[model samples]
Target: MLSGLDPSGGAGIQADIQAITSLGCHPLPVLTCLTVQDTRNVYGASPVDAELIRQQLECVADDSTIHAIKTGALGNAGIVDVVVEFIRKRPDVPVITDPVIKAAGGGDLADDALITAMKERLFPLAEMITPNGEELVILGGDADADRAAQNLMDRGCGSVLATGGHGTGVHIVNRLYNHAPDPMQWEIERIGGEYHGTGCTLAAAIAAGRATGLSARAAIAQAQNYVHRAILHALAVGKGQPVPDRGIQWER
Candidate 1:
């Protein structure tokens, strides 16, 4: 379940829903914050109280057999704490976390302390944590992606998928590192334009794959393909950036 809802239909729960549905899995969304924004940027955001989030999570968990979860844009420490609590109960379920530090238009999504809270509390529980280069710098305190991912792994995350969008390169290379045999790497032809909610789409696709019982390596591979296809057909909803068309099917 995601931590926020974006009304723009580009990111947050909207994006999650689209990605998960495209993968043929049911999405169980639990909103922890409400964001006011268009495709351009986040104008304002307010988090739901921890108790309310807890109630929503409890209700969902009780009513349905949740297969997997994808989390994005948790607004604060209180929300992180509550989410961590909920995740702790479902130790067997796979959890993919898209660490949302800033918006596509550079708006702050979480404070420094909130980031710390996530590193300490939530990172350990994640089956995979997808962070862009900028977010890795903040959380891993290292400029090198490999070193940064290692730092996160030491802290407890099962794997780190460091996306190459924020880096300077001719090709976007996403690296998956952890306790696996070796790191899995995917190099894709870099799309020319900036796309909003790509990370959210990737994480949700991974979650859907995991929910359907794909192994970690297979899930990551499938998710990368889905994300690339979505971005290739991204929708230009606003002036700032294109939003991923998560419904696009990757036909062979």
Candidate 2:
């Protein structure tokens, strides 16, 4: 299940649906926020009612054996509280949370209270939290990824995958930090050009990989590879940034 729903199919739940299905699992979408935007910028947003969200989650949970949960762009504190309570009931399910605090086009996705709630309430329940360099700074309450990730881990999160896409460099490094002695890292040649939905795609792929029985570490690696390929074949659908071609032909 995914929380944010993008009408443009550029990111959020639509991206999650595509990525999850591409990885050979069914996508059970649950919308926590509604985004009004194209591929370029996020113009506005409105969160779905918390009670309505509860009903949707309960309905899905009752009918399906959900293997993994992916969350993104939770718009407000109300939604965060609702999700935290809901996930508390299913401690066995793996949760991959893409901490979407801002849009790729520089729009605010969450308020201060929501961010605080995520760190205080949501992080502890996550199997892994994926945050880009910028978001890591906010979540970690520090300037660097290493320090920020460590801060979050100390706050009870199971693990942190600090994405390096937002940083300037020849290669993009995605680092994974968990209970192990050392954090694992994957360095990929930077793909030229801006693309929408990469974070959503990566998180959903990780969830699908986990749902299909890959171990957490293996799932992270596989998901990274999948996102790379998707970006490699990304499409210039809108006038703004290109969108990752999640429908690019591939075998699972």
Candidate 3:
């Protein structure tokens, strides 16, 4: 796992760890940046030294037999470059990237340079990218969801999972675009109220499913189900948004 640190434990690496562990996969967490944030919003962020991130990744790689990689808020272009280089060396591992451009509370987490780096370098290396509707539009550079997904695929991304949390609707729709001509989609009943760490939890759960040998389609389906259940059992941790009850038991 490569991501930022959220002290509130509502998102970022903390959320990744919880989701991965719950799904029975051991996480090898590598911090890319640190954020001063809570359930309400992100106040500020600072990227960890790129060299330090590289060293952490190298050390973890040398020590563990990595099954999957999941990345979240990489603070800058330099951090993205480091992650890209690390992923290049381990081509066999499936990578699930959550293109975190803005926080759930509407705070900007990434700028143009970092976004460009991810589009050019990191997206090509990922097995799949989990982006909400807004992120899909920004990254794909098109307003239409289908066109945006295609633009990403054209840029060498293996697949796109456009989530519907940010969209206006009665049901949350998540679509997966892959080798098939038509995309696979799931319409989950939209749970009322906002929840923090949903994107991280869903992406990490997918990584865990892939690590445990589930197919991409299966992994996506199961992960979405898992997140829905989690939100249904959410915890009122702070004044802003509820945190998913990731500890809710589920049969593996």
Candidate 4:
């Protein structure tokens, strides 16, 4: 995993590791950004140096059994470029990128340069990029949902799953589009609550599914279904923000 830090462990790499582990995959993570943040909002974030990133990737890449990868909250363009080049060497691994643009609690995660870097470097390297409604807008400024997804395809990802969590509707809708397969839409009722790291958890869950032998489409479906439950039993970990229990079903 590549992501910003979450001091509260309610989001970012902390959440990704938990979600991946809960889904029965061994979680190996690489942190791209260190952040001063609680569940409510981010105070500040700085991406790590590119050399540090390359060193981490080199170390982790030594492990031969890692079959899948997930990325979230890269702090800048430089980090994205380094990661893109690294992944190019392992085109066989399934990569699920959670293109997180803003904090669920309303803090901005990427500036213009970083956003451009994400589009140019990271999106193309990913097998599937997951962006929520707000992120889609940021990823494809002025493009609507369908257009944004298409733009991502044009930019080179094999697939884009543009989640509609912020749109105005009683039912939360998640849509997935592939360059080859027909598009599919999945909807669930909007459970009333504030949750952080939902996107990261979802992406990691998908990666975990892939590691466990599911095809890309089946992996995504399992992830979507798992997210519904994780949010339903979300635990309030901070005064103002909630973290979904990746083990939501463990003791139920």
Question: Evaluated with TM-score, which candidate comes out highest?
Answer: 3
Runs off by more than 4 Å, candidate 1: 180-182, 250-252
Model 2 spans with C-alpha error above 4 angstroms: none
**Global CA lDDT computed for model 1:** 0.87
TM-scores of the models, in the given order? 0.95, 0.97, 0.98, 0.93
lDDT-wise, the better of 2 and 4 is: 2
Error (Å) of candidate 1 at residue 92 is 0.7
| lDDT string, candidate 4, 26-116, tens digits | 8878888888888778878888898899888888788656789898988888888888888888888888998877887677888989888
Worst 10 residues of 1 by lDDT: 243-252
Relative to the unseen true structure, what is the C-alpha lDDT of residue 9 in candidate 3, on a scale of 0 to 100? 87
For all candidates in order, the CA lDDT equals 0.87, 0.89, 0.93, 0.83
Of 2 and 4, the candidate ahead on TM-score is: 2
lDDT of 3 by residue, 71-133 (tens): 999999999999999999999999999999999888889999999999999999999999999
Q: Which residue pairs collide in model 4, if any? A: none
Best by lDDT: 3
Cα lDDT tens digits for candidate 1, 1-252: 775788878888888888889888999888878988778888888988889888988988889998998899998998899889988999999999999989878888898888999999999999999999899888898987778888899999889998886566678898999867677888988888668888888888899999999998798888888888888888988777889899887552
- Clashing residue pairs in candidate 1 are none
Worst 10 residues of 2 by lDDT: 1-10
lDDT score of model 3? 0.93
Q: Supply the TM-score for candidate 1.
A: 0.95
